[model samples]
Target: MLKKTRVAVFVSGGGSNLEALLQSEVSGGMPFGEIALVVSNTQGAYALERANNHGVEGVCIPSRGNSGFEEELQALLMARHIDIIVLAGFLAILSADFVGKWPERIINIHPSLIPSFCGKGFYGLKVHEAALERGVTLTGATVHLVNEIPDGGRILLQKAVEIRPDDTAKTLQQRVMEQAEWVLLPQATAQLCQELSEKLSEGV
Candidate 1:
């Protein structure tokens, strides 16, 4: 029997992506694991509300005056016994120290194809807006390993959609979000879980 590893989702927004993941898990289409927790940096992140709605253990630790929040964040994650960390709309750049501890165990989803409209000041609709300004004929989402520099992770999977001449940022973003459901999150998480299970069997 394949063991189901536990996953912890980190989010900083509405958590629509997280919802997709939860639905995927519920559908039993994934090859491995299920969400064990939903951790958020925002106390009131709607993501947290979604977590509650799904009965997922929700841990909210906003930066909230704590200058050493990164260390606290790391400690919290460790205590949760998280096997994998999924950055679902998690905006804050985790400290390099924390990232080093997790290594490829961390993953994130970006709105635009990386190595393009990604970097400081690029996120959410800002990325979609840039794609519109550049008149990109094709646009999509990328799922990748998390790194120190935002959006610099090695690409695990990416899916592109042709942008119509009339495509606005909102329309393009809606399209990308739809693709995000079909392309990035579900398949990647299943692959990650399978890989983790294989490594365990190999005693790596």
Candidate 2:
């Protein structure tokens, strides 16, 4: 049997990617051990409901714009002994101290390929809108390690989607999610877990 690695998924929105991850695990497509928890910074996030449907423990720890929020987050992570953190639509900017502790263990899915249509002020439909404005035929999603430098983390995987000539931002966003984000996030996560497993066996 493969040793289970506890995964904690963070989300701040609808959590389509989170749903993908959960479904992947349920269908035996995910190589990781299990999704131990789902944490959302927003109280009303639909992602929490999805977690409940799967019988996974979901918690909403609202960001209070104070040190208390960080303390609560750190406590939850430590308590669960989480092995990996998957940021599925999570928008909160983690503190430098938090990133320092987890390092490459945290991974995030970005709407657009990194180094383009990413970084500050580029999120949600804005990413797709920017791609269309630039007249780019190809735009996609990127899965990367999470660091303090916004989307500057090392890229793990990127999958491109073709942008239709008459596509609106919403339409393009859906295509990218269907073709890239949903497919690549789980794959990258499985690969990361496999690498971690090998490292463990090698005593790294």
Candidate 3:
């Protein structure tokens, strides 16, 4: 069997994206990769529960208001031999040291087409609100590499969802997830993992 690329998903909320990824992995929809770990910065996050239900190891490593959180997180990821890190609603800003250590190995899924309703302070419902405020006919989700800056990375994939006239921020959020985010995230993950696996086979 080909060696599967191990992925660690980080989250700070309910982890619906993580759930999609897990389902994809088990259904053989996400070829070349497996979810090895789920990490949450907040103990109250329900994402951790979803991870356990999926039979994946999940842990809570609170930030504790310091850089120590990154150190502990790094150790845990390394111990699990994680190859890719996906930020699925993870709220903490990654330190420069952590970004440097991971480089392009880290990625995130944003609620809107990046550079549109994205950047710092554009997450969760705020992104959809911004799109609605701007009266854009179409808004969608983006999967991109995670960098030192928030939501300012090379775009890997994007899928658009039309903004209905009657949509509220909450409704728009659900539409984006169902129509775009859920679809693009797993596709991007599989694409990235396949590329990584091929590169490894080539000894690159």
Candidate 4:
């Protein structure tokens, strides 16, 4: 049997996808994973609340003036023996120091198909509004390796949602979230797990 991967999820929102990941892993009868830690950059983030409710240990690493962000983040991951990192709705651009340290070990779920309506200032409902204004028939999510600057990395997987004629930013955002939490989130984590597995098997 393959050993379960110890994954750490970082979030800055309601952590709906984190909830989805936990649910899927528990019910899927799969024995290849566990969420070791859920870290939040903001003290008030609801993701932390979710983590607390689930009894998974949670930590808050403040980005305030860069006091100890990298040190604290690295320490937490190391202490957790984290094998994978997932960024779910985490808005801050992680430091190059951190990304360089982790490389492809980190993943982010972007709110658009990427290269279409992604990058700095295109997060959250802003992305939905941009897609709608551009009249694109499709707008969705992209899960990719995290790099310095927003959306600045290789594309891993993308799944799209249709832009209806009556789409408001809120309406479109709802669809994007649904696509994210229900499908892309779990699939992305699984894909990363497979990639890491292959990387190990190749070296054997």
Candidate 5:
């Protein structure tokens, strides 16, 4: 049997996107990927619970006030032989040093399309708020390679969602997740996993 790529999902708060990825693993949407570990910067994050429910290992590294945060995180990823890292609503900004170590091995899901309501200070419902405030008729999600620049990496996939007339920030956020983020994240992860599996098979 071919080996499955080991994946680590980093999350903060609710981890709705992590839930989608976990579901995909079982449903064959991500056949070449195995969610080997879930790491959260916040202790007691609900995402850890979601990982546990699916029988995947989850840990908390506690980024707040911890200078060794990335060091500890890197050690854990190495110990588990993590092949890819997925940032699903993880709030902390990773240092360039840590990001350099991963190169294109890390991916992140942004709430809005790049060069739109993305970059620093736009996260969670705030991205949706900006789009609504700007009166954009269409806003969507983007899954892209994680780089030192926030949401500046090469795009992998994007799906557009229409902004309804009655949509508030909260409502728009939910719709984007349901219609775009949930769909694109899993597809992109699977694509990377398949590519990585191929590279590994060739001993690259």
Candidate 6:
């Protein structure tokens, strides 16, 4: 039997994206991938609760004011044999050293197209608010590789969402997730997992 790629989802918020990935796994959308762990930097994040409900191991490793945060995080990931790391609403900035270790193995879901309302200080409703303020008729979600640069990684997939005239920042945010982010993230993850599994088989 072929080995499944172990996946770790990192989250800092409500983890709606994480939930989508979990659902996809159970529905057999991600045939080569299995969600092995869910890690949150915030102690009380609801994402942890979702992980618990799914019977996946959930861990909290606070990054704030912790000098050895990355070391500890890397250790936990290694122990779990995580093959792919997905950042789903995870707010902490990974150091270049840590990012280099993962190379193309780390993936992140951003709320907007790259070189737009992305990069530093742009996350959550802020990206949507900027899109509305700029009067762009179209904005979307992007699933990309995670590099040291925030949201600057190579794009794997993107799905556009229309900006409605009556859309507030919060409303626009919800629409983007439902119409684009949730869809693209799982698809991209499954693609990566399949590619990785094939590569591993080739080497065997």
Q: What lDDT does the true structure give each of the candidates? A: 0.83, 0.89, 0.91, 0.82, 0.95, 0.94
Query: lDDT tens digits, residues 1-204, model 3?
Result: 456789999999899999999988988988899899999999789999999999999999998576589999999999999999999989898987899898889999999987898888888999988899999999999999988888888999998899999999999999999999899899899988888888777778
| Per-residue C-alpha lDDT of model 4 across residues 66-157, encoded as one tens digit per residue | 77787989998998889889888887778888888887889888888879888878888888888988889988888888878678888888
After best superposition, candidate 3 residue 20: deviation in angstroms? 0.4
Clashing residue pairs in candidate 3 (N, C-alpha, C atoms within 3 angstroms): none
TM-score of each: 0.93, 0.95, 0.96, 0.91, 0.98, 0.98
Better of 2 and 3 by TM-score: 3
lDDT of 5 by residue, 59-111 (tens): 99999999999999999999999999999999999999999999899999999
Question: Of the candidates numbered 3 and 4, which has the greater lDDT value?
Answer: 3
What TM-score should be assigned to candidate 3?
0.96
lDDT score, candidate 6, position 151: 90
Note the residue pairs that clash in candidate 2. none
Model number with the top lDDT: 5
Residue runs of model 6 more than 4 Å from their true location after superposition = none
- Could you tally the backbone clashes for each prediction? 0, 0, 0, 0, 0, 0
- Name model 5 segments beyond 4 Å from true: none
The per-residue C-alpha lDDT of model 1 at residue 25 equals 85
Residue 21, candidate 1: alpha-carbon lDDT: 87
- lDDT digits (tens) for residues 4-25 of candidate 2: 6778999998889999999999
lDDT of 1 by residue, 61-131 (tens): 77657688788777877787777899888887787788888888888888877777998899888998999
**Every model's Cα RMSD, please?**
1.5, 1.3, 1.1, 1.9, 0.7, 0.9
Residue 5: error of model 5 in Å? 0.6
By TM-score, the best candidate is 5
Measured on C-alpha atoms, candidate 5 has an lDDT of 0.95
